[model samples]
Target: MSVTPQASGAASERTGLRVTYDGVVYPAEEIARGAAYELFSADEATGFEWAPRPGTTWPWRRFVHVTEVTEVQGGNEPAEEPEAPLLVPLHRNRSWSSVHQLSQQPAAADDPTLAAVRGSATVRRGTRMVKVLTGRQLAGYVRGWLPHGFCYREHDIAHLRTPAGLAVLRGDGTSGREGTDIGYALRWRAADPGDFDAPVGETYRGLLALPPRDRLGPPVLGTGFVPSSAQLIPEFVTRDFADLPMPANASLLAYTAEGTEVVLYTYQAEQRGWLRMVGPQWRHLLAAVPGLSPDQEYVPTGDVPRSTQLVGSYAGGEYEAVADLPGGFRVLAMTRAARFPVDSVARRLRYARWRGVPCLVLREEAGWLRLRLCRPDPDAVVDTGAQCHERGVYETWAPAPEVTDDQVVDLSYLV
Candidate 1:
């Protein structure tokens, strides 16, 4: 959470928002070069929506007007002029408005620019080295739970310190990682509960018990668990689960050890229980992980598992490929499927029933095998194919594409 809390003169502005970014608000004219945003709102939450934060809209708060802009000398072009902070009261419901215009391309607020001298909101805490993530980053983390059919949520977190240790009871860390809302939360480990701060920890734990998919109420609370003796109660709780269409008042748990330098771990779940690698080489690993779909079949051929049937055929005197398959019966105009598996599925088809009519001669030229996305894995037992594909039947990780000429397939088109 690098968004610096810009104190609104003796008053609070955008009180409940989960701050997503912070930077100089770009002027409307320079919006393209100024900032980038996700078009998300609590009203219609779905995907990673991008846009600038909304502006003020209350009655008394609306009194403060946007001050005149004064351009500073810098950049090849002029620097963005700053608008003096105003104190305008807005309707609490619609109070959260973008600082920039919303109807058109927005002048993004400043969030990306960083300096050696200036520390981020994460850095300022000074207790634990924080891994500050953008709402976009947070959303991606939430999506990883899809394969296993789980969903992770965001909540306001405020770790209030206590005597036993930092016990959170009512902190916004369980706050929403929202599109329209923008706010911040902190994660720290004081020597003891009250060693450094009070109320913050108790507040954080309390949020874990919040009900799921409901974001309109106060944050929930959690029972104290010894960090050393326990694993996250449900492994899924600690993961960066994204498939969650339903949101829960999730926990912002700290390492139980006293000042053990709590580290944050991110989890991503796919259609299966698959996960992308986390930490070091994350850039390269994330890029490669999706490409390597683990096997998704139910049977075994030699050491290989039954998977998508990928076969290339000679059609019209030219060499092409067959589409890969995971199920039976397919329709392929041209076949040139590749060999790869996500969990245990394969990508090669040795043969398929050549479709035909009983005694119909000219009408039945006999069509060959076809490839597709969700077909079943091939194996001996019709009963076995069902069992294996459903529970990782294959052993071989399908090889890469190698369309050899002599390969045989049941279809006449196969060479």
Candidate 2:
């Protein structure tokens, strides 16, 4: 049987997807009956597409294949042995077939952490130092379904060796806050130890060594895609932790009380590049660290200036910001071209359920929208989308008189 990587604009045409199922890559026609799967669009040169489905709005199910993949040596030759999956580096993009292939393989044969995850009989969660030794181990695995690329960076490679195995801990000087909507941090284990002996960047380059395509599309645009497997690691770890079943009397505060006392100047730290926690979370920190106190030093932050093009008129005026919110943040509109009120806007900005938690969308600066969980900060200026929903209102940032819901083009072309 013949198998090949999908072609440009093939999805829109009669040619269906190149789907990977049960360790095999099959054309759309050859996909086994009753197979459960998702779709991936070809690289930029080939535009994104959606199939006829049962909804007025698009479901965020399809993903675009961003990695460089092509036919290998003896392109048309018969298979000698099932081809070993190509392992892409952490924080990089991969083709759907590559991701599917990598997911099936064992992360590491001798890794204890993975064994714990699988509920292996031999693995044990012993009394280990909590601070010095992190419960989380860096394991290797490919991104399952989400679109990945922004997290890639150049940094010194660090490895942590536990009773489990050698873990490749990703280290970068860049701030985590900078990037497109963070999909999730990926933890991977090396399939081969020799992969570690080589420089990490060199290894990544080797894995991503496919020749460049003559026709490539621009990078994905903001708000065009959502990550399906973004929180896999956190969810998996949380489930495993819950499954272990700690005792009813288990007190996290008491548990840490037995450990050596550790003091932290949280407020001072926040002033010097650390994050500030509020309320019960602060108590949780106090439980973990001995001498920590609430914002006793309550250092106030000055308002960061943001200029918006606000207009006042008779039938209410046209108001728009010079910048639009970052992609992925959903918003609710309170008013259109009305005199911006200070008190009423605060009342309108209440937390609503987002991904099962309360959230408000605030466009802080150009190319960045913050989905804050707690109440909006005192200085926050919330956007009502000018009477639009989710990301639709962002279209008004264009020079046209006003952008409607139908006018929002597929910005994924930039992606």
Candidate 3:
């Protein structure tokens, strides 16, 4: 029932279909197309796909795919219904409510950092505040659907707002932190509908081309705010650290307040999304580690091995990475041993698989290694006897080396 007129200079002008499902109606072209694609795509349409919004549950799935779609105009008679089960109605497709709590004042009225500011867009709705997305954020949302087995999408343009404007808010938090943050997205006018791989927010002026739309009125916000427990994209808050090269076989771990963490695998490149700690285990680790503080950094000294080396027999010893012990202070488990044959510690560990069968080797700190168990026999016990002898004969162990300050990236920025 709520409506916000398209921005003045949108690249295209097209009438949107009015779709009624489960009693609620949507007038946005993108919503209509998404709804139609879900409910009325031809039986032979091979490429149609849908990205079920996050936190979708039972029963709703039955009705989302309808045998027949009814496009409402002028309040015409209801279309003939199939014998299918009733569809669950979504209310918040086309609504906007003023935000009440301002997190940070809107971008200084005229900051040149629209993309940066917009990248972290949050809008006010009544007394509640929500996140909004634009550009790549929107595109990523649409793409997330297909991979999750929603439906194969043909044209992403259908998701675009008329008049070719940016700052398309995925009403409420459909693709963001539900009930908390509103998602803002940008729809590119020149985007190839069939090609969803196009870069987002590439054309600066193009994204900011349309004048901002005024958002205030009734139908205030979409009604169907699905209860979501997952965020479409993981957000990272970068901080400045002394950029420096890591020591041999070392990794840096980053932790945040929401029980979220990512291991920094900088050896190959400045990569992310390595091993993580979450769920019950996260709760356990969170008991320590500075109490789950966001933007907290945990640099590994690689002095103590995450895994323990056990001498099963005289032949060799087995090294398996194990969980960390909870504590407030750090201790270095140091020992001396003979050096190994391999040039690099990673290669040495990689060559130590007892059965001569190859498995993934994840290097912890120095003197410790964890095998990425990939063999079918989950219960198969590993023989570290031969490897232990090899280690004593071919490898040398020394005290955990000191970490140099210059090896960190200076990502700190002033608020």
Candidate 4:
């Protein structure tokens, strides 16, 4: 819809000026010396409308969560200091053919040159990390799963907007399923670059050596990118394959085959829940999500244990904090006014051995500690009695007293 920049008046001073597009109000900021306005919103507000701007491309309305007014600039900003190889999008007409050819390439796990190039890629604290999810994985994250395993930087793949365009980047090995019209993804700001490691070097050689049956997704291409013959999108894994705490405003999204981007849900870290944003028309997307009711407006996740958390000290007391980011980290409070920037913040995680298996302590109950296997294999799952929640993720509970060598550690990644 045509976005009429609100006049610079009293309303601009209060909530800043906003632009309405497709019935949603977005807080707009003047960027590039006022040549274009960047519209961004963390909330899922609606009820406003605007006429479509003439000559707008298909991606215009698809920029649901963030977009620049000029339409030429996608939400992802180019790196201030380029380190990785430049990536250019293929012609829309040739994208599918190119992706198919690239997906067929043999894994380049032993390519030293490619590995070094990929290893050189870096993630800044505020870099947007993206995990393309299957319908089942999307459901898991909506429930309580934190960001873990393999992911990519949003800056590298912003041009791939549609389901077909993103097929090459799928983490699941199996492809070419029919009737798949929508693609799902989770995007969030990186709380710390140290939490990520390129799946290269001797550390990940074992992952590359694993037989096909033992692994879930595509093989780890030491090239630090997806299994593509041409795409240079660098891939990363959480350090020690541990879960990174979900930051505030993390978004669960859906992209139609036609390239319409839908904001399915935006995480509310304070409430430890997801605020559903998908309208009635898109409710069918949730049909594939196991046990999740499409009609439910907000899903509470506080009760579900997590592997890592953001904690902060404020007013002489330690409290759960949310990474609001750019604005900085703050203590998560019930009311908006109560959320204040904390005096100190750190990531709280505990590692322990249960039944001779390395596990990350999720949470502690009366006498039991919920633990997730750091690396899930068939034997580990059986030994720990861990239930398979999703591909490559397993969790179970153990008696707190029986869990040996329990140690709580706090990490600070603030710059």
Name the candidate that leads on lDDT: 4
Ranking by lDDT: 4, 3, 2, 1
The residue-by-residue lDDT of candidate 4 on 22-123, one tens digit each, is 555555443322323434444333421232333321112222222223233223353344324333244656454453344334354554444444555678
- Can you write out model 3's per-residue Cα lDDT over 1-415, one digit (the tens) per residue? 1121122001112343344555545332222223222222212222223322222211111112221345554332333221112222224651111111111222221333322322332211111111123223322322221111011111211222211111222332223232221123221111111211111222111212212231111111111111122111111100010011111222222222211122222121112111222333333322322223323232222232212121111124322111111111111123213212111111011222324322333343554444332221212122222111100011112122311111211111111
lDDT of each: 0.20, 0.21, 0.22, 0.67
Show the colliding residue pairs in model 4: 2-51, 23-48
Candidate 1 residue-wise lDDT, 236-340, digit = tens: 121111011111112112221111112122221112121222334222212222333223211111222222222333222322222221122122332225222
TM-score of each candidate structure, all chains considered together: 0.16, 0.18, 0.20, 0.70
Which residues of candidate 2, in runs, are more than 4 Å off?
1-277, 284-293, 296-301, 305-415
lDDT (Cα, 0-100) at 194 in candidate 3: 20
Better of 1 and 4 by TM-score: 4
TM-score of 1: 0.16
RMSD of 1: 23.0
Q: Which stretches of candidate 1 lie over 4 Å from their true place?
A: 1-38, 41-281, 284-415
